[model samples]
Target: MQKKSSIFTATHGVMTTEVGVISGELELRTTCNDAGILTLAITYVGAEEWYTLPGEDYRLHDPRDHEVVHRMLTNVLERT
Candidate 1:
C-alpha cells in the first residue's frame, strides 16, 4: 500500500528543487510506497504540477513511521 500526506506551508526561505529555489505559499506532499521508500514533493497551492523536494527520496527504516515523518516535515517547513 502507498500512503500520502499533504500540507500547506509558508516556507521561511527559498526551497531548492530540480528547477531551482522557490519561495512562497507552497503545498508539500509526502508519499510512502510499499517498499518503504518515501518521496516528497511540493507545488504552489492548488497547482496540478508537483516538483520533487530537495532530498528527492528516502528509504524509511519502518514504513509505519511515515505519518510521524510527514508531521515532522510539516513542522520544519512551516517555519516562517
Candidate 2:
C-alpha cells in the first residue's frame, strides 16, 4: 500500500454559510493499493487516533463514498 498525509487548518465555516467560525487542524491520510484503489482516513491534527464513518472503512471506490466522507468530516468538525 502507498500512503500519504497532510495537515491543514480547517474552519467549520467552509462547510456552511453561517458567519460563525470554528477552527481546528485537520489531518488527512490517503492510502492506495497496487490496483490504485484509494482509502482515506482522518483525524484532528496532532491526535493519535483516527476515525472512519460508522459501518464504513477508509476505502473509497466511488463518488458516493467521497460525498459521504465529506459529510462525515464536516459533521465531526462542526461539533469539535
1-80 per-residue lDDT for model 2 (tens digits): 66666666666423322323324776666566655466656666777767542333445565335445555554555553
Error of 2 at 37 (Å): 1.6
List runs of model 1 lying over 4 Å from the truth: none
CA lDDT scores, all candidates in order: 0.76, 0.54
Q: Best lDDT goes to which candidate?
A: 1
TM-scores for every candidate against the unseen true structure: 0.81, 0.51
Please name the candidate that would achieve the greatest TM-score relative to the true structure: 1
Spell out the clash pairs found in candidate 2.
Answer: none
